[model samples]
Target: MTKFNKIVPDDFNVPMYVNGEFFILRPLSPVYSNLDYDAVIASKEILGDIFSDNWPEGINSREDNLRYILEDYQDFQDRIGFSYIILDDEESICIGCVYIFPSLYEGSDVAIYYWFNVKFAGTYLTVKIENFIRSWVVEFWGIKKPAYPGRDIPWSEWLTRPRKKFTD
Candidate 1:
């Protein structure tokens, strides 16, 4: 039998660099009021089907966004799950988000989900970021085989099928 260890949120060091760019992996907080809401709304059009059920609605105002951020922050603090705001090297821009939480799948303990601005969708940076995330979770956090539940689409089709070479 294999020994199972739980991942504690404090084990992670925030604002780590990956792929030659500085990026932060801290949980969402109210202090992130500087988020570019307009850009997030704009990306929805480009996100297409991926944005369907995963994205939150009713973020028409900063207050709404803050509320969601606060909730996510609390979740991280409680070690229930983590929702990180992916920031730029200067930590001045919010380019995207990465969520790590308990798996909804029947036999998995953890799962991951991520998204970036449309501008990064087809770039090598996206692939690097994704690979960095997987390696980080396994090596640093000890989640050897994290799950990616296909809530938005079928897992086999989304991950294994021949698709656009966005992330290699």
Candidate 2:
């Protein structure tokens, strides 16, 4: 991961938006922070458990979420990472989020994390959504050995390995 800030190749076309039968994936701006904030807070406990991290802890305010969403959007624009807000098929409700970022470990091309609202955790749509994401990363993005640290590799093992952060 030496200076591997760009997860995909320069010629690769990063998908900014994806529309599927079950859900829609798109970058969210600060203007839609309310929807993102609502889903984040409502699914805080579950999301923390899913990621095994303390994330939505201090993000109790919509303003705080707005800043985070702005950063997410900026990351996509910069082409360093990709984060998408998963909305319902109608594109009105924020259901969850999925992220694709350069892996900090040596063996993986990229690290991916996706979580859904607790209510949709085990639902059919969630399963389909996860499949779509995995296929998109592998088939569309051409990511080999995409690391799903929490799922495929346990978080403990992943953290124990040496890190390879992006260079300045």
Candidate 3:
């Protein structure tokens, strides 16, 4: 397994343009629980056939979502790397979240998982959000390159369950 870099507060909020709107990024916290879940579920509904199949479930309840966030925070603290919350300034709400994990196979590689709500599903917004997400990764993770060429998975091809491991 790849050792995770301990995530510490950098004392600054990351910025991104979400469909011409500006959003501030902060470390995922207990307060982000409901917003994260609602946004993701909303995205799943709105995006319809344009969503990730590997998205984890069980976020329909606030209590359950809180537990999930806490676990994720602990995981990040323990070495899962960085996870962040995207907050809307005008509306004062969180509309999305993303998690970055160190690659177990290579120290120089990282993986990102993200979800946004349906309210932000317009094509322009989608492109902006993707740009925002990747930019944050590049800046925070100390990646010298924009993205690992020839190693990124296509969104369409990633819509299936991962291969199962078997042992006797």
Candidate 3 local lDDT, 1-168, one digit each (tens): 434454334543433233325666666768677777777666655434433443445556778778878877777556545567777776367667666654333323555766566676455765676786777567755654332222265554433425223222
TM-score of 2: 0.91
**Which is superior by lDDT, 1 or 2?**
2
Tens digits of per-residue lDDT for model 2, 1-168: 244476666788776578888788887767568988888988998877667577888797988898888888887877878888899988888878899888888888889988887768889998898888889888888887899978778988988878776675
Error of 2 at 140 (Å): 0.3
- Model 1 lDDT tens row, 1-168: 222232355655543333334566556677665574644666766644454354656677777777777877776766766787777777777767777776544444576777776766667776777777777778877776576655434665444534222212
Query: Model 1, stretches more than 4 Å misplaced?
Result: 1-22, 51-54, 151-168
User: For model 2, what is the error of residue 83's alpha carbon versus the real structure, in angstroms, after optimal superposition?
Assistant: 0.4
Report lDDT (Cα) of residue 143, candidate 1. 76
The lDDT for every candidate, in the order shown, is 0.63, 0.82, 0.58
Best by TM-score: 2
Candidate 2 backbone collisions, by pair: none
Q: Is candidate 2 or candidate 3 better by TM-score?
A: 2
